[model samples]
Target chain A: MKSSRPPMPQLLEQVARSLAARKDPALTGIDVETLCAQLRERPPPPPAQPRWQDALIEAQIPEGASVLDLGCGGGELLHRLIRDKSVRGQGVEIDFEAVSQCLTLGVPVLQTNLDEGLREFPDQSFDYVVLEETVQTLHQPLRVLNDVLRVGRYGIVSFPNFGSWRVRLSLAIEGRMPSTPALPYRWYETPNIHLFTLLDFLELTSEISARVVRGFSLVEGVVRPLGLNDNLEADESLLIITRDPPLA
Target chain B: MKARLRKYDPPNSPTSVGWTKAFTWRLTPPDTPWQLECGGHLNEVTVEYETYGELSPARDNAILIAHALSGDAHVAGWDRDASDTHRPWRKNKPGWWDAVVGPGKAIDTRTFFVICANVLGGCYGTTGPRSICPETGRRYGLSFPKVTVGDWVRLQARLLDHLGIERLHGVVGGSLGGQQAIEWAMAFPERVARCIVLAASPRLSAQGLAFNAVGRYSIMNDPLFLNGDYEDGQGPDAGLAAARMLAHITYLSESGMHQKFGRRRRVAHGPKSGFGVEFEVESYLEYQGRAFVERFDADAYLYITRAMDYYDCAESWGGGDLATACRRVRAEMLIVSFSSDWLYPRAQCRDFAIHLCRAGRPVTYVDVPSNLGHDAFLVETDAVGRLISAFFNPARKGWSI
Candidate 1:
């Protein structure tokens, strides 16, 4: 049967035109090769090692676990598990090219937007569902987290902590959206239309009745637990959450 | 022996194929040989790679440099007097990825032997969609089996075996090359001592995939594609060019664009003038697209991009757990991100570090402040070079000095 989809080139042309017209001034024109070379020449900053998430996952995931990766881009993370951890996995993404790339890489990825819902997948289908840097983009972060909690035995959420004093200061003093290395885009062009801080996420998790298995902030790549004593001035943080109580 | 070699030579004067050359080496996987997921076929495929640096004795100093999209084995320092305007390994003049891989540079040939391979589905000297199928003399074209990062990594592993190297000091790559670096550490943890993944992510971002999809759609939509069978003059040049243009845009940053060609009039002296492509940026994009099509194969473009699209490490684990994937990775990893690179931003690199830390893997993450976007990894050589040297330097570990 002939598919009803438009021809690929025409669709691409339309998208190309739109992209060109809507090119972000902040991201538009630069010689990348030249710039990349320059960046490579400098000494890298001190390494930041985050160890908390590693401990939590190791303690939680049993042998031969099934995983579902939301917004699995380029299969880097997914491929890591398959080859290193020996875990079975699947991914869902809204981008057709990404799904195609995933398929090319031999990853099983379904091309679908999470915000639209995952009716195609049955409830409790995966041992774990991970949302890596995906919370900020969703129009409804709470619903997506709820759905992720429902589908997997455990959930992992990681995002830049907007509550960090640096970000808050940028908002308070600079009077503009913060553009840290973690969140580089300006207010008008930011992909994160729905911004939330680490504390905001915790409150939402509580309202949804999700229990925080373990949560920590990454300082210079080192994973440290989120606490009042610790400095919240760091740029990024990761949170690992689970459903409350025991499943009957 | 010389007389015997001469006797075996062809009667007619050998005509140089000109501009391009390819070489392939058969590779057997360490585990269960490569199986094409699309058709479930067990296949023994050969990886075609090219070399830029001389090998040294002891062979412990080899640095395998992987290429990103539209890049090949021709790292740099090509013979300028070579017959072809387009050097054997590089298509565009001056060559892409040349800024960092030459002598006296970050990946200095004096220190490390560099070997770069045209990826499995690449148009350059590699077994790709353009290559004639052994079974059916015709090119595989669209019929070529889909390839994955694992497939590429397996091929590279074979290349390493062929070179008689049991272990590598480091594997450096950006973008897709970065993906290959990640796979190398995962697939053969013992083989790689240090890995540098630059401006690369653990998986494809939805935004990134959307861009890739549009690029592919642009290519496949051309009527000349002829369902992937356009072998003659009627090729999908327009679509391919459009795809290249779109991809070229992603490689650049808006700040860079503004700095280089903001609202500038094109052909300032020419009578054939208008607002169309009046800015230097538009002309640059056109030039990039036009130059790209002169060498790249449309089918290979489709296949390779598809491979990138399908890349997801977590999917294979079935648990959707990125941390689990890194549990077994033994190599010390250095993940770098550019502040300006929206394509594969710092957020993605942070995500990778988070998972690696969660898996109890030793990883160093650096978010370099730069407005160079994703391309910063290539051009910011001085910065990246120092980081790599320090990271790999065993003497510098744990000591503030």
Candidate 2:
């Protein structure tokens, strides 16, 4: 997906143009072209990719498809989908502040807890149900997963992998609950009540008679193909859950 | 000079719409009588309505606000002609919902044309129990036909037609008004684009019915009630005061009352209050009751509360099934319930949203946390206003962070 943030060159040019046009006494001594050159000579930033949101878009959801986002935080992903993919999106968020943000983003949202399940939605009501990075925080993650799959044909879920090497190393060496970039919380203050690895999630799908159509390992903010040791290597996992397994 | 200042001055807010006047429209004439849901008809009906802001050229920006029990058409702005209109109750303050309906407020008067009308059975400047019956040439005190929430919506549609508004951008209300808002979507599926129902349910609860029954009983048992034909200003003041006092208790939560009054005694008075006012809470309720009797009509109260009691969305729209009833709504729905509002409650509003969803309607439900009970919809302006303004104009960039 295209980033709304302008590239470095375009941003610098915009700043330079504004500076050159200004007649303010304080800015008169500043040279616009020199500033632009100084800013651009720095190391080029990495390509903006591998956010769970970007990974979800890579799943190639059809244009104008109906999307329901459970626990849509400030509706950033849903808004991105609507703007870029022209998808009709709805969001369910439990926080009022986040719900207000979703409204301002022009995404239809309901303020509801996920633990209660998506009983408001009819069966197969949407083309895709995205539960990004919210499964572990729920009291009944399995129950919500069942409902998510029941409500939409495809369920795209992303969560922090507890089996990541960094987390394991932290726990083993320090002898305390681990805190990584993905699960950045102390034991008592953590919102993540249920912790599971990538393999545990894949196992959960099979137990519920669901199948994983696609899986991505996101390590250090880079998306990679699911690997044999991904359960211990990946920081986060993204999966496309469906009712039937993929063709051989 | 004091009365002049009170009647003519606008509110202190810069966004105030200034002073407003109530306008009368002959909505139903003798030839085109309004049909009632209770199998009755009324002819030569007049409606008192007030409008704020300009209608968009496309006429789609009109929002009709339905008032709750004891509310009137003066929904925003100070009533300039309150004395002339004989609605002295409106002179001292701006509209009941002034907090949320100003130029830059939630239901922004700058962008949307806001219209509020006194209900058909209302006491304030509308054809109610106080209005003379065109056929009998007498006041329709006990004679007024039992009106329903459906009747109110149908009449509102007629008012819209008279105003040349083909469709509404939105309809909003709290309590009884919220029920009307829902009824608008169900009754005129093609007319409304959005509907916001706050602090209301599909029907009044059994406990609510019990309270209304006792209030009506108080009014009826009064000697001055005189079978609803007594002279004006001499009819059931005591009974009406008692009724208002009882109903006011239901509109506030125990926590709110505790925070406001606690168990503290009135410090100014001695402790020798046998049945008189000793507790501050008692004095507050007495003032509320006395103030209500000065403004509202006992007969209109009976009709309105009865109408509220009779409202069953499933029974009226569906054949005893809520999901079937929900299918009639075509507008996007926003249902809000205050957390401490036992009068309507959050659970019932959630059920309403669930049914709407089951019927394939696009709905958003929020339970706003407040200890103000049902009154929170009116008092908790900042939170409610943000939610409303965002709902109405979603997708606008640079909304407050």
Candidate 3:
């Protein structure tokens, strides 16, 4: 999606300029002695706990299982596995900082460009592979799915559905990219390099000889089974469980 | 005050010595000996530091830059020689932290009086395992106290007190330097207004500890270690080199290694068919190790690495709750992590940020995109400098200093 805002560099420069212009006295008003006293008096704050994904992985992952988490930003998903599942999970990321974050967390992660093929991992390297909110960002969704199927016994893919009637209506009426909490950034700034519909994914899966183990839609953060009359065109999110065909 | 010359100098010193030729100023803080986590004890300790910019009349504009494991107190600017030996201030070597400490840079010497001190267990001017023992008047060697991160923080606090600068604008560092920065904010939150922690963790991971352990083991197991008292003229240069090589590998990324060496052959011709020092990477690592040995002490390496291994901020508070540990911090913080740095990855940094956020502290977290590995913070000068400058900009309402 083309961003409505200025280019990334220009936006960053603007932010920097705005920050540079401010002169808050609270930071500058204190005397050295007073500041030292203040520093000694104040203690540091606590760390944040994991969110919903952590809970989901904890409840679902079997003990001692090997998992592959794609687009695992900062290795948070792998950390959840290590802490809750005691599972050894590897992550694939394109961003260097996110990989560093994984290392700092002490989780094993491989740096790979997801748009390309996953030739790095041998076939069936993982019992389960998860692609969380990552499919929409891929330029070649089928290639990723096929690769995941090759490396994992089971695959969990989640994506925001452009086929949702709300999104369709928004686009039809507003003629501008929709910006919901699910899709926080403007079109030009969004990392959703490629957007796909549920039907498109299903078609790709059918062509790749993958079988859907389970399918569900999430609306207003509630997960429910997808029924014939479910009207996925209005659902906010979708999750699919698929299995790759046995070798040969 | 002129920089003091070392009382003893070994013969055959290189004629064109590096920056050490330029001597500026020095100060001897009051001698306060202390014990280490290890059984060793030190009777007297001295800290060496350097300052840039001016201390305002009110002494409120002081910024402290903590050095990494191998860093000294020379943060920026040139030495007396006017050459590029200490080019942190000039555009030369750029002083290890020149990006963050120059006139218009993030730390901005023009506005903030910046002080960078070599850690307590450092081989620099500070007293460490390499310093002379007062009782025997010989280099302490193995007899030096095994210091901890806490001890280093305490010494820094003492230095601040001596300077009569009660509060700091902020404490900034990356890698081990980041450890010191976090400790300063936690230990004396009221004394520091802000903290910039880049490529650091609340505690050293087991993997990190393991790497450090192997590095230390390499040095200690060297036949030449001689139980740490290798002062008989011969020392564990081989072991130290091996340790440096291993640790250096961690500092860089796989891609970086490929780009730097990529199985390229060295100029030397020997055992080309076998596993000799044929790769350029091997030669480069050797050069790094050899250069390190010339300026560093083996005993100091043991103390510092041991101190790093023992670094666990959660242990200091009570339980292993990092958020609880930082509950009292009033300082704003900026926690930065690099993408390719497998050493201190982004998840740990995010955890730090989450904890800070949970504790209701204001913090800005940036995961910079880079493939330079842990060393990215030092090499990605433009991005880091921009973040630091923005973080420390005095005009910002919440963090003007």
- Best lDDT goes to which candidate? 2
Q: Could you arrange the candidates by DockQ from highest to lowest?
A: 2, 3, 1
Pairs with steric clashes in candidate 2:
none
TM-scores of all models?
A: 0.57, 0.88, 0.60
* Candidate 1 residue-wise lDDT, A1-248, digit = tens: 11122223333334334544677331144233432342244223224332334444444455567777788775555555654566666666666446445543444444446786444345786778878778899988877888888877788787877765445435543455676656667677788877777767888888989878766676545556766522344456667788758556
Q: Write the per-residue lDDT of candidate 1 for residues B1-401, one digit (tens) a residue.
A: 01001111111213211222345676555532556545433344556665655677878878788788877776554324334554432322333455565555556666677677878877776677777776787877787888887778767877888888888878988998888888888878889877888889877798889889999899899988987889744689999999999987887788977776776756566555455665577778887777778778788888888888887766643256676678757776777777788888777876775566445454555666677777788777667776665554433322110
- Misplaced by over 4 Å in model 1 are A1-248, B1-34, B37-46, B52-57, B79-82, B85-95, B267-275, B394-401
Model 2 DockQ reads 0.23
- What DockQ do you compute for every candidate structure? 0.02, 0.23, 0.03
Per-model interface RMSD values are: 16.4, 5.2, 14.7
lDDT of all the models against the reference?
Answer: 0.66, 0.81, 0.69
What docking grade applies to model 3? incorrect
Evaluate residue B275 in candidate 1 and report its C-alpha lDDT on the 0 to 100 scale. 56
The digit string of per-residue lDDT tens for model 3 on B1-401 reads: 11112222111222111232222223333343465545565677777788877899999989898888877787664344434342222223335665556666667767888888888777777877777888999878777767888878877887788889999888889998898888888888889988889999888889899999998899999998988888734789888888887888999999978986788777545565777567788778887887677656677888888888888887775377776787867787778888888899878886776566545455556678888899998888777877677667676444121
Worst 10 residues of 1 chain B by lDDT: B1-10
Query: Cα deviation in Å at residue B100, candidate 1?
Result: 2.2
Q: How high is the DockQ of candidate 3?
A: 0.03
